[model samples]
Target: MGGEWFEVLRPPYLPVEIRWERAVADGLPADVSHAFGIFDTTLCGVQEAGMSPSDHWWLPERESACDACREAAGVIDDRRPRAMRGEDARVSVARRL
Candidate 1:
Protein backbone atom coordinates (compact mmCIF):
# COMPACT_ATOMS: atom_id res chain seq x y z
CA MET A 1 0.00 0.00 0.00
CA GLY A 2 2.78 2.38 0.84
CA GLY A 3 4.78 1.96 -2.34
CA GLU A 4 1.81 1.34 -4.58
CA TRP A 5 0.98 4.99 -5.10
CA PHE A 6 2.26 8.50 -4.54
CA GLU A 7 0.95 11.99 -5.13
CA VAL A 8 2.43 15.15 -6.67
CA LEU A 9 1.22 18.66 -7.16
CA ARG A 10 0.93 19.86 -10.73
CA PRO A 11 0.15 23.32 -12.03
CA PRO A 12 -2.48 25.28 -10.10
CA TYR A 13 -2.17 22.86 -7.16
CA LEU A 14 -3.53 19.84 -9.03
CA PRO A 15 -2.86 16.66 -7.07
CA VAL A 16 -2.18 13.68 -9.33
CA GLU A 17 -1.44 10.05 -8.58
CA ILE A 18 1.76 8.35 -9.75
CA ARG A 19 2.99 4.78 -9.61
CA TRP A 20 5.85 4.19 -7.21
CA GLU A 21 8.08 2.30 -9.64
CA ARG A 22 7.59 4.80 -12.43
CA ALA A 23 8.31 7.64 -10.09
CA VAL A 24 11.46 6.03 -8.77
CA ALA A 25 12.73 4.98 -12.14
CA ASP A 26 11.83 8.21 -13.85
CA GLY A 27 13.46 10.45 -11.23
CA LEU A 28 11.90 10.04 -7.78
CA PRO A 29 14.72 10.04 -5.27
CA ALA A 30 15.19 6.74 -3.50
CA ASP A 31 18.92 6.93 -3.04
CA VAL A 32 22.08 8.51 -4.43
CA SER A 33 21.30 7.61 -8.05
CA HIS A 34 17.88 9.29 -7.92
CA ALA A 35 19.11 12.22 -5.88
CA PHE A 36 18.20 14.68 -8.63
CA GLY A 37 15.01 12.92 -9.74
CA ILE A 38 12.16 14.70 -11.50
CA PHE A 39 8.95 13.08 -12.75
CA ASP A 40 7.30 14.40 -15.90
CA THR A 41 4.05 12.59 -16.63
CA THR A 42 1.27 11.46 -14.29
CA LEU A 43 -0.71 8.24 -14.19
CA CYS A 44 -3.46 9.94 -16.19
CA GLY A 45 -0.94 10.69 -19.01
CA VAL A 46 -0.68 14.39 -18.29
CA GLN A 47 2.83 15.41 -19.23
CA GLU A 48 4.48 18.44 -17.67
CA ALA A 49 8.20 18.79 -17.68
CA GLY A 50 10.05 18.74 -14.36
CA MET A 51 7.38 17.61 -11.90
CA SER A 52 8.49 17.08 -8.32
CA PRO A 53 7.20 14.39 -5.98
CA SER A 54 5.29 15.16 -2.82
CA ASP A 55 4.95 13.28 0.48
CA HIS A 56 1.18 13.82 0.53
CA TRP A 57 -1.60 11.37 -0.21
CA TRP A 58 -4.06 11.78 -3.08
CA LEU A 59 -7.22 12.97 -1.39
CA PRO A 60 -9.96 12.46 -3.96
CA GLU A 61 -12.27 14.86 -2.14
CA ARG A 62 -9.82 17.69 -2.57
CA GLU A 63 -10.90 20.40 -4.99
CA SER A 64 -7.54 20.24 -6.77
CA ALA A 65 -7.45 16.42 -7.00
CA CYS A 66 -7.09 15.22 -10.59
CA ASP A 67 -10.12 13.13 -11.57
CA ALA A 68 -8.37 11.46 -14.51
CA CYS A 69 -5.50 10.41 -12.28
CA ARG A 70 -7.94 9.06 -9.69
CA GLU A 71 -9.73 6.99 -12.33
CA ALA A 72 -6.43 5.78 -13.78
CA ALA A 73 -5.42 4.64 -10.30
CA GLY A 74 -8.75 2.83 -9.86
CA VAL A 75 -9.49 4.98 -6.82
CA ILE A 76 -13.21 5.27 -7.39
CA ASP A 77 -16.14 5.35 -4.96
CA ASP A 78 -17.52 2.00 -6.16
CA ARG A 79 -18.57 0.12 -3.03
CA ARG A 80 -18.72 -3.25 -4.79
CA PRO A 81 -15.84 -5.63 -4.36
CA ARG A 82 -13.71 -6.45 -7.41
CA ALA A 83 -14.93 -10.03 -7.38
CA MET A 84 -18.56 -8.92 -7.48
CA ARG A 85 -18.81 -8.05 -11.14
CA GLY A 86 -20.68 -9.34 -14.21
CA GLU A 87 -21.94 -12.97 -13.78
CA ASP A 88 -19.79 -13.44 -10.70
CA ALA A 89 -21.84 -10.79 -8.89
CA ARG A 90 -24.92 -13.01 -8.77
CA VAL A 91 -22.88 -16.00 -7.62
CA SER A 92 -21.22 -13.94 -4.91
CA VAL A 93 -24.56 -12.63 -3.66
CA ALA A 94 -26.08 -16.12 -3.55
CA ARG A 95 -23.14 -17.40 -1.55
CA ARG A 96 -23.46 -14.53 0.90
CA LEU A 97 -27.17 -15.25 1.47
Candidate 2:
Protein backbone atom coordinates (compact mmCIF):
# COMPACT_ATOMS: atom_id res chain seq x y z
CA MET A 1 0.00 0.00 0.00
CA GLY A 2 1.20 3.50 -0.91
CA GLY A 3 -0.61 5.03 2.03
CA GLU A 4 -2.80 7.09 -0.27
CA TRP A 5 -6.06 8.33 1.20
CA PHE A 6 -9.47 8.72 -0.39
CA GLU A 7 -12.59 10.61 0.69
CA VAL A 8 -15.70 8.45 0.74
CA LEU A 9 -19.38 9.00 1.51
CA ARG A 10 -21.05 5.77 2.60
CA PRO A 11 -24.60 6.95 1.96
CA PRO A 12 -24.43 9.15 -1.13
CA TYR A 13 -27.92 10.65 -1.08
CA LEU A 14 -27.68 12.54 2.22
CA PRO A 15 -26.86 16.19 1.68
CA VAL A 16 -27.22 18.14 4.95
CA GLU A 17 -26.03 15.45 7.34
CA ILE A 18 -23.29 13.93 5.16
CA ARG A 19 -19.93 13.22 6.78
CA TRP A 20 -17.12 12.04 4.55
CA GLU A 21 -14.65 9.37 5.62
CA ARG A 22 -10.98 9.00 4.80
CA ALA A 23 -10.27 5.47 3.56
CA VAL A 24 -7.20 3.68 2.27
CA ALA A 25 -6.93 4.03 -1.49
CA ASP A 26 -5.41 0.59 -1.98
CA GLY A 27 -7.39 -2.61 -2.70
CA LEU A 28 -10.71 -0.88 -3.27
CA PRO A 29 -13.33 -3.15 -4.89
CA ALA A 30 -13.67 -2.66 -8.61
CA ASP A 31 -17.32 -3.70 -8.58
CA VAL A 32 -19.69 -1.40 -6.72
CA SER A 33 -21.89 -4.34 -5.72
CA HIS A 34 -18.91 -6.10 -4.12
CA ALA A 35 -18.17 -3.05 -2.05
CA PHE A 36 -21.61 -3.22 -0.43
CA GLY A 37 -21.05 -6.51 1.39
CA ILE A 38 -17.53 -5.80 2.63
CA PHE A 39 -16.66 -3.94 5.81
CA ASP A 40 -14.54 -0.81 5.46
CA THR A 41 -12.66 0.75 8.38
CA THR A 42 -12.04 4.44 8.00
CA LEU A 43 -8.93 6.25 9.25
CA CYS A 44 -10.87 7.68 12.17
CA GLY A 45 -12.01 4.20 13.35
CA VAL A 46 -15.46 4.28 11.73
CA GLN A 47 -16.45 0.83 10.50
CA GLU A 48 -18.85 0.49 7.59
CA ALA A 49 -20.49 -2.88 7.12
CA GLY A 50 -23.10 -3.90 4.49
CA MET A 51 -23.04 -0.45 2.98
CA SER A 52 -24.99 0.55 -0.11
CA PRO A 53 -23.64 0.34 -3.67
CA SER A 54 -24.58 4.00 -4.06
CA ASP A 55 -21.67 5.00 -1.79
CA HIS A 56 -19.82 7.87 -3.37
CA TRP A 57 -16.02 8.31 -3.59
CA TRP A 58 -14.79 11.80 -4.30
CA LEU A 59 -12.74 14.74 -2.99
CA PRO A 60 -15.10 17.01 -1.16
CA GLU A 61 -14.22 20.47 0.13
CA ARG A 62 -12.20 20.45 3.39
CA GLU A 63 -14.97 22.25 5.31
CA SER A 64 -17.54 19.48 4.71
CA ALA A 65 -15.00 16.65 5.14
CA CYS A 66 -14.36 14.59 8.29
CA ASP A 67 -11.87 16.29 10.60
CA ALA A 68 -10.88 13.17 12.52
CA CYS A 69 -10.28 11.08 9.41
CA ARG A 70 -8.41 13.87 7.68
CA GLU A 71 -6.11 14.37 10.67
CA ALA A 72 -5.54 10.64 11.10
CA ALA A 73 -4.83 10.18 7.40
CA GLY A 74 -2.38 13.13 7.43
CA VAL A 75 -3.94 14.59 4.30
CA ILE A 76 -1.96 17.50 2.82
CA ASP A 77 -3.54 20.64 1.52
CA ASP A 78 -4.32 20.29 -2.21
CA ARG A 79 -3.60 23.97 -2.83
CA ARG A 80 0.03 23.55 -1.78
CA PRO A 81 2.59 22.62 -4.46
CA ARG A 82 3.89 19.05 -4.47
CA ALA A 83 7.54 18.26 -5.14
CA MET A 84 8.20 17.20 -8.74
CA ARG A 85 10.48 14.32 -9.69
CA GLY A 86 11.56 12.03 -12.58
CA GLU A 87 9.27 12.25 -15.63
CA ASP A 88 6.93 14.64 -13.86
CA ALA A 89 9.85 17.09 -13.34
CA ARG A 90 10.30 17.57 -17.08
CA VAL A 91 9.91 21.19 -18.09
CA SER A 92 8.11 20.43 -21.35
CA VAL A 93 7.02 17.52 -23.58
CA ALA A 94 8.82 19.11 -26.52
CA ARG A 95 12.13 19.00 -24.61
CA ARG A 96 11.73 15.28 -24.11
CA LEU A 97 11.20 14.73 -27.83
Candidate 3:
Protein backbone atom coordinates (compact mmCIF):
# COMPACT_ATOMS: atom_id res chain seq x y z
CA MET A 1 0.00 0.00 0.00
CA GLY A 2 3.03 2.27 0.37
CA GLY A 3 3.70 2.29 -3.41
CA GLU A 4 1.80 4.34 -5.93
CA TRP A 5 -1.08 2.51 -7.59
CA PHE A 6 -0.05 3.95 -10.96
CA GLU A 7 3.58 3.01 -10.44
CA VAL A 8 2.79 -0.68 -10.65
CA LEU A 9 1.74 -1.25 -14.24
CA ARG A 10 -0.64 -4.01 -15.16
CA PRO A 11 1.11 -6.94 -16.72
CA PRO A 12 0.49 -7.47 -20.45
CA TYR A 13 -2.24 -10.06 -20.82
CA LEU A 14 -5.06 -11.06 -23.15
CA PRO A 15 -7.50 -9.49 -20.71
CA VAL A 16 -5.88 -6.25 -19.63
CA GLU A 17 -5.90 -5.88 -15.84
CA ILE A 18 -4.49 -3.64 -13.11
CA ARG A 19 -3.19 -4.34 -9.64
CA TRP A 20 -2.69 -2.26 -6.52
CA GLU A 21 0.29 -2.43 -4.12
CA ARG A 22 -0.22 -6.10 -3.37
CA ALA A 23 1.71 -7.35 -0.37
CA VAL A 24 1.55 -10.76 1.24
CA ALA A 25 1.83 -9.19 4.62
CA ASP A 26 0.38 -12.00 6.66
CA GLY A 27 0.75 -15.66 7.45
CA LEU A 28 -0.15 -17.80 4.46
CA PRO A 29 -2.50 -20.73 4.36
CA ALA A 30 -1.02 -24.03 5.47
CA ASP A 31 -1.82 -25.63 2.12
CA VAL A 32 -1.68 -24.76 -1.57
CA SER A 33 -5.37 -25.25 -2.34
CA HIS A 34 -6.50 -22.51 0.02
CA ALA A 35 -3.85 -20.13 -1.22
CA PHE A 36 -4.85 -20.75 -4.83
CA GLY A 37 -8.50 -20.15 -4.03
CA ILE A 38 -7.73 -16.85 -2.35
CA PHE A 39 -5.94 -15.66 -5.51
CA ASP A 40 -8.69 -16.93 -7.77
CA THR A 41 -10.43 -13.65 -7.00
CA THR A 42 -9.38 -9.98 -7.27
CA LEU A 43 -6.45 -8.11 -5.78
CA CYS A 44 -8.62 -5.91 -3.62
CA GLY A 45 -10.32 -8.86 -1.99
CA VAL A 46 -7.02 -10.62 -1.65
CA GLN A 47 -5.51 -7.59 0.04
CA GLU A 48 -8.47 -7.19 2.33
CA ALA A 49 -8.15 -10.85 3.21
CA GLY A 50 -4.45 -10.35 3.99
CA MET A 51 -3.03 -11.29 0.62
CA SER A 52 -1.01 -9.15 -1.76
CA PRO A 53 -2.42 -5.73 -2.54
CA SER A 54 -1.28 -6.40 -6.08
CA ASP A 55 -2.93 -9.40 -7.71
CA HIS A 56 -4.07 -10.57 -11.13
CA TRP A 57 -7.52 -9.99 -12.59
CA TRP A 58 -9.27 -10.29 -15.94
CA LEU A 59 -9.57 -6.52 -16.29
CA PRO A 60 -7.02 -3.82 -15.46
CA GLU A 61 -8.65 -0.47 -14.66
CA ARG A 62 -11.59 -1.76 -16.71
CA GLU A 63 -9.44 -2.24 -19.83
CA SER A 64 -8.90 -5.45 -21.81
CA ALA A 65 -5.39 -6.85 -21.30
CA CYS A 66 -2.73 -7.96 -23.73
CA ASP A 67 -2.39 -11.70 -24.46
CA ALA A 68 0.92 -12.22 -22.70
CA CYS A 69 0.07 -11.30 -19.08
CA ARG A 70 -3.40 -12.76 -19.38
CA GLU A 71 -2.12 -16.18 -20.31
CA ALA A 72 0.60 -16.11 -17.66
CA ALA A 73 -1.81 -15.02 -14.94
CA GLY A 74 -3.99 -17.95 -15.87
CA VAL A 75 -0.89 -20.16 -15.82
CA ILE A 76 -1.06 -20.67 -19.55
CA ASP A 77 2.10 -20.61 -21.64
CA ASP A 78 0.91 -20.15 -25.20
CA ARG A 79 4.30 -19.37 -26.71
CA ARG A 80 5.47 -22.88 -25.86
CA PRO A 81 4.09 -25.37 -28.35
CA ARG A 82 1.99 -28.20 -26.95
CA ALA A 83 3.89 -31.30 -25.95
CA MET A 84 2.97 -34.95 -26.29
CA ARG A 85 2.64 -37.41 -23.44
CA GLY A 86 5.92 -38.87 -22.18
CA GLU A 87 7.91 -36.58 -24.42
CA ASP A 88 11.62 -36.60 -23.70
CA ALA A 89 12.06 -32.85 -24.00
CA ARG A 90 15.20 -32.70 -21.90
CA VAL A 91 18.25 -34.72 -20.98
CA SER A 92 20.04 -34.48 -17.67
CA VAL A 93 22.35 -36.73 -15.67
CA ALA A 94 24.51 -36.12 -12.61
CA ARG A 95 27.24 -38.35 -11.16
CA ARG A 96 29.09 -37.74 -7.93
CA LEU A 97 32.75 -38.71 -7.75
Candidate 4:
Protein backbone atom coordinates (compact mmCIF):
# COMPACT_ATOMS: atom_id res chain seq x y z
CA MET A 1 0.00 0.00 0.00
CA GLY A 2 2.76 2.47 0.80
CA GLY A 3 4.67 1.90 -2.44
CA GLU A 4 1.87 3.36 -4.61
CA TRP A 5 3.99 6.35 -5.60
CA PHE A 6 6.83 4.08 -6.60
CA GLU A 7 4.51 2.14 -8.87
CA VAL A 8 4.37 5.12 -11.25
CA LEU A 9 8.12 5.79 -11.34
CA ARG A 10 8.93 2.95 -13.70
CA PRO A 11 12.29 3.03 -15.46
CA PRO A 12 12.57 1.55 -18.98
CA TYR A 13 14.51 -1.74 -19.40
CA LEU A 14 14.80 -2.30 -15.64
CA PRO A 15 11.69 -3.42 -13.82
CA VAL A 16 11.02 -2.08 -10.36
CA GLU A 17 12.43 -5.12 -8.55
CA ILE A 18 15.41 -5.36 -10.91
CA ARG A 19 16.02 -1.64 -10.68
CA TRP A 20 16.08 -1.85 -6.92
CA GLU A 21 18.57 -4.70 -7.21
CA ARG A 22 20.64 -2.69 -9.69
CA ALA A 23 20.70 0.18 -7.31
CA VAL A 24 22.04 -2.15 -4.68
CA ALA A 25 24.49 -3.67 -7.10
CA ASP A 26 25.78 -0.38 -8.45
CA GLY A 27 25.82 1.22 -5.01
CA LEU A 28 23.13 3.82 -5.47
CA PRO A 29 23.77 7.39 -4.43
CA ALA A 30 23.42 7.37 -0.65
CA ASP A 31 21.28 10.50 -0.55
CA VAL A 32 18.75 9.09 -3.01
CA SER A 33 18.25 5.87 -1.07
CA HIS A 34 18.58 7.51 2.32
CA ALA A 35 15.94 10.17 1.77
CA PHE A 36 13.58 7.82 0.00
CA GLY A 37 14.10 5.23 2.73
CA ILE A 38 13.07 7.77 5.34
CA PHE A 39 9.86 8.60 3.52
CA ASP A 40 9.10 4.93 2.91
CA THR A 41 9.88 3.94 6.47
CA THR A 42 7.44 6.57 7.65
CA LEU A 43 4.73 4.85 5.69
CA CYS A 44 5.69 1.28 6.66
CA GLY A 45 7.13 1.17 10.15
CA VAL A 46 9.90 -1.19 11.27
CA GLN A 47 9.28 -4.52 12.89
CA GLU A 48 12.29 -4.66 15.19
CA ALA A 49 10.92 -1.66 17.07
CA GLY A 50 7.41 -3.11 17.00
CA MET A 51 6.24 -0.39 14.65
CA SER A 52 3.81 -0.74 11.77
CA PRO A 53 1.72 1.46 9.52
CA SER A 54 -1.34 0.86 11.62
CA ASP A 55 0.45 2.31 14.62
CA HIS A 56 -0.24 5.87 13.55
CA TRP A 57 -1.57 6.46 10.03
CA TRP A 58 -4.10 3.64 9.82
CA LEU A 59 -2.64 1.87 6.79
CA PRO A 60 -5.83 -0.23 6.45
CA GLU A 61 -4.01 -3.47 5.62
CA ARG A 62 -1.29 -3.90 8.22
CA GLU A 63 -1.23 -4.16 11.99
CA SER A 64 -0.11 -1.47 14.44
CA ALA A 65 3.45 -1.03 15.70
CA CYS A 66 5.28 0.52 18.61
CA ASP A 67 6.99 3.27 16.61
CA ALA A 68 7.70 4.21 13.03
CA CYS A 69 11.07 3.51 11.40
CA ARG A 70 11.08 6.79 9.47
CA GLU A 71 11.44 8.63 12.75
CA ALA A 72 14.63 6.67 13.33
CA ALA A 73 15.81 7.19 9.74
CA GLY A 74 15.48 11.00 10.22
CA VAL A 75 15.33 13.67 7.50
CA ILE A 76 17.63 13.87 4.49
CA ASP A 77 20.33 16.51 3.94
CA ASP A 78 21.51 16.39 0.31
CA ARG A 79 25.18 17.30 0.19
CA ARG A 80 26.67 14.81 -2.21
CA PRO A 81 30.33 14.05 -1.85
CA ARG A 82 32.69 15.35 -4.53
CA ALA A 83 34.54 13.08 -6.97
CA MET A 84 38.11 12.23 -6.11
CA ARG A 85 40.80 13.52 -8.48
CA GLY A 86 44.17 12.36 -9.90
CA GLU A 87 43.76 8.60 -10.00
CA ASP A 88 41.12 6.06 -10.89
CA ALA A 89 39.87 4.95 -7.46
CA ARG A 90 38.66 1.57 -8.62
CA VAL A 91 41.89 0.27 -10.16
CA SER A 92 42.50 -2.99 -8.36
CA VAL A 93 46.13 -3.45 -9.60
CA ALA A 94 48.71 -1.25 -7.95
CA ARG A 95 50.64 1.02 -10.37
CA ARG A 96 54.39 0.86 -10.52
CA LEU A 97 55.98 3.88 -8.84
lDDT of 4 by residue, 1-97 (tens): 2234323321123212221210111332223221112222432231123212221232222232212323332221112112322232222344457
Q: Could you tell me how far off, in angstroms, the CA of residue 3 lies in candidate 1 after the best superposition?
A: 19
Tell how far residue 97 is off in model 3, in angstroms.
32
* Model 1 CA deviation exceeding 4 Å by range: 1-39, 75-97
Could you tell me the TM-score of candidate 4? 0.15
lDDT of 3 by residue, 1-97 (tens): 2334334332233322232222334453322111122453332233235454335333423333333334444453344334411233332343446
What are the clashing pairs of model 4?
50-66, 52-65
Tens digits of per-residue lDDT, candidate 1, 1-97, equal 1111233222221122332223223443333111112356665565545664455454444455555655655543244455443432332122332
Residue 57's lDDT within candidate 3 is 36
**Root-mean-square deviation of candidate 1:** 13.9
- Runs of candidate 3 exceeding 4 Å displacement: 1-23, 26-70, 74-76, 84-87, 91-97
**TM-score order of candidates, top first:** 1, 2, 3, 4
Candidate 1 clash pair list:
27-37
lDDT (CA) for every model shown?
0.39, 0.36, 0.33, 0.24
Give TM-scores for every candidate, taking all chains together and pairing residue i with residue i: 0.35, 0.30, 0.18, 0.15
Stretches of candidate 4 exceeding 4 Å from the true structure: 1-40, 43-79, 84-93
TM-score of decoy 1: 0.35
| Candidate 3 lowest-lDDT run of ten | 28-37
Best model number under lDDT: 1
